[model samples]
Target: MELARWTLETDPAWNEPRIAAQIKLLILDALGVAIAARDAESSVRVGELIDELGGNPRCTVIGRKDKTSLLSAILMNGTQVRALDFNDVQYFIKEGKLSVAGHCSDNMPVVLACAEYLGAPGSRTMEAIAMAYEMFGRLRTLMPFVSPWDGTSVSGLIAAAIYGRLAGFDLVTQANALAMGAMRCSTPSIVRWGKLSEVKNLANALIAQSAVQTAMLAGRGVTGPLEVLNDRGGLHQVFDPALDFERLWAPVSEPPFIMTSNIKPYACIGTAQAAVEAALNLHPRVKDRLGEITRIVVTMADLPMIRKQQAEIHRQYPRSREAADHSFTFLPAVAMAEGALGDHQYRDRRWEHEDIVRLIELTQMEVSEDLARRAPGAMPARIAVTLADGTVLTEECLFDSGHSFPDRGLSPDAVISKFTAITAPFIPQGRSQRIRAAVENFETTEIASLMALLQ
Candidate 1:
């Protein structure tokens, strides 16, 4: 298969110093979210389940004292990383359309697990993650938003490739690994929309587990359709028939998708980040007159406005933390009223508060063609607050602060600040320092050493 040939010939490595540092930064950001989620409701429930399914305890559950089998640890760790929708995200915008999107860090736990299993060095783990992100971006160019296919559909394939490489699989076995896993990793996009659930947290984790198993099975001579990507009724036929299958084999981009992936500075989904930023920009000007505010108008990119602003019961409602992140309703309302957005806003069903609800009700969302043209890249948002005195205060955010493309990305110090902020409740100052240091000097550190700090 072409994928096998590419995997074998086009070797992966984090040789560039800048890319290496960025990879380490991504690791720190991922761990920040995963560690901070140690007490999240989903993490707690899943932690209980992981404890029940006790196995060899071969892998760390990450940011927790618990240990479980490799696969279980992947599930638990992945769930925790996504529990807060605070992990890093990668978006593929082809021809001004959002083709596919998801958290790049979703592949981190599985790679770390494989590295732990093989006693691999931190260098190998970094290269493996870089490869996974490259694959995610390449594969995403083919899986557009027009289909029901979710971003996790690429997770299993990426996970399989990582395992095959770490385990020293031959080219044939490696291709089979990807194909075998891809055939089984068809995830729907619904998990992330409309009253999101804990299932959203588990989607990528479960897909990674299956993908790892498929790769392992391939190592044992188990076979699957090698032509899964090109068969008469394959992925294109199943997802979007018009999908450009050739994008799957296109050369991986330089600097890779991991570098472009966003490091979220807020505790909300990517689509809402810019809107929240805009609202916060308008807060100081309108905070004192919040009660006098007649209506808050938020204009954003097309797709999200339609998907996140239509109706409350449909999905826009802040029914839960998951749904709240996707809601333009709760995000801007809180940001404007409080002048900040973070973990605390999601507590106590804050959206249910009378003032917040009234603010939410008074909020109106509209689509902007100019802004829509910039989406999946800049994610521009404009917030116009109308007052009782017939005055309109407006602010616009061209890009979310977390965005990392075309320069002006979050600085390492900014990333560190975010890490310290989110993880303060769970990780002590000394321990956080140690973790940060270990990640900074990741090339020489062992995979086990890094995981140890997380535990």
Candidate 2:
């Protein structure tokens, strides 16, 4: 009731010109990344699973000419968004440590599927997306879960909020649905730990998939512990013990979190973006002297929270495609040696090159305490190359260019260029233009028509 009380009280959307512009860009970015990954191994495997487990076909899956049940469609589209590890990510600062609390756009598939099913217009979808962004930002900041407990633990609840608003669930029903979704979808964080498997991309998507049914049950008079929100044996028990419901539910007067999220210029983990920039910045400089280099040093933020699994020695030496993307050593080495970072660098087992492996061997990942304090706000990385002649050429990137800060974020034109570049190979110029127009003017466009463009 309290959540609904505030939900009904605050404006669902901050529909000014800039707000509309930013939301549309973020949506376009998510959709582009998803479309690029339509043929990923994760997508194919999940498609097979969808076929084996049959449901009514009524929803569209991005980049494919097929229909699926709402849940399967969400799973397929959500997995595509994350399959390449290149989706939009929102990081949070807690006690001066930058921690990734999962992606807000992971639930975009839920909103899109819901919009198609409800035959909702793009205006209504934008409103629901704004609500989902608001709730995710607050929970991610106030009482978010990090490593050891997957961020999807928080995302599932926000997915329910979007579902509730779009489906016209009453205050109590929506709130109860949030609780039910939370109770059911706290997946283990191990999926991202150590050597990552294909399942890593499917973790949050799995939560979104299950949320479709659980949220609907609440809408259909399925009762859950409403008090589970703050009372014992619920959020307080499973998530943060000292939960601050008031702060978490407080209305956000600042810009929506979508404005601060990073759209991921590189196809690697969020933390590795700075490393890519750092490596790329020094790539041209080191191109001629790469062989003369004796060592490559990457200065990174000292992240104690997530240091256990990723910082381990074996993690630095990637053994699989998933591991290569998350590998700090592999990323910088490949970028420095190849002068680029993207899905292409990882394909064909290019990281296995003896020269790249030699670079990885020469690479060392170091952390700076000062850098740690500035993280999540500014992801800083510095690359220092030590040549055999004792010459050092250094480059430092204070933040990834793709970050959505007002002062120096990625420009609208650049974002559009990125979308066009990545999805150009798969999508024709005409269809790409049509989708861009629809999303840019999304507040007035029809969801069904836009989805048809994607299909």
Candidate 3:
């Protein structure tokens, strides 16, 4: 019953039907995000690989043309889903800070891949998604006493559950899969601390890989330690210093839907949220005044954590993607000089423009207690542009366009358009349309039939 103590069975008020609906909606939303960001090289790499490895029709892998082996398909497609860190996120109330998000896409790819492997119907895909989300959410909610660890703690277990369900494993086998998956995948938090290596993008990929491996091992009747969650040397003791199991279980036991998920408009960390919005808003007005600014002050809610405040890594001049992604010092400075920030802005040599360097020289980010006291998902960044002639313009951004725009809260059409816009340049028009159509209407098609086209 330890598995029961850790998942859907633990929640007495659990609604199987509602959980299913939530999962279906989550997948749809996730696909929309993935499609929008598909053109990024990381995403393209995965998609192109899937397309080249055509196999028996089995599952719907987004942004690719062919059905591949389930394991390969999920690994590639799921990695694309998070290649840019621009997916939906849901947080648990227990820690108030420790949250879980698109790593669930790790579960989605594996689950859908299994659907292909079995030639299962959409109904089966839907059920697998629901169970995966519920089980994942439950594990995330249940473990608070462990930290210094990352969300992979929750992600791996959820992924394993998805893999097990798709592979026709029973409750015990599913539990074992989760145990082994977690054991293999858990890690320290430094992976995301400094620069924006492919590490953030690969976090979910690693967990998904572990999930698939665990499921395969379980299928062969392999058994792992069952006390993975409850053992004295288990996750909580090893990972989190301040553990609280009761509060973690309370929300899941009562089974309240933690649907307050936030979607990213910019592919960056939580700390950069407000600054990105502020720059996007002020860019239009300040474009003509690029050389006139005396000082650019970005007032954030809190002193950004260790990595974000690194002057040398980002402010001194970011040399790599990881540094650029986490550079609180660099993003606003670049936004000030260019009037906009896009995927190209991250890669282009334009980031080193003299004007941007000057802006970086002039820009300073300060912490405000009032701002920090505000709630999550409500990012508040204040930009005060002081001109050479002593004139000053100030703007505050509460939410970025894609995430907070009234009609733009991660809309499906918008996501589809984003996907097409980014990927069309790299893929053939016909292939792009085919992939988009399949992603948009996945429920109606056999996953394998759709996957076959990808190849």
* Ranking of models by lDDT: 1, 2, 3
Q: Candidate 3: deviation at residue 284, Å?
A: 1.5
lDDT of 2 by residue, 4-113 (tens): 55543446445656666777888998899999998888988998898898788889889878788988998999999999998887776665666775678888898999
Q: What is the TM-score of each candidate against the true structure?
A: 0.93, 0.94, 0.79
Candidate 2: segments with Cα more than 4 A from true spot: 7-13, 142-147, 303-310, 370-376, 406-410
Q: Worst lDDT window (10 residues) for model 3?
A: 401-410
Runs in model 3 with CA error above 4 Å? 2-29, 32-67, 91-103, 134-146, 238-258, 303-317, 372-376, 402-445, 449-455
lDDT of 1 by residue, 5-102 (tens): 56544444346666787788888998999998888888988899988889887889887676688888888888888888899876666656553367
Model 1 misplaced stretches (Cα beyond 4 Å): 8-14, 98-100, 238-242, 302-313, 372-376, 407-410
Q: Candidates 2 and 3: which is better by TM-score? A: 2
Clashes per candidate, residues 3 or more apart or on different chains: 0, 0, 21
Better of 1 and 2 by TM-score: 2
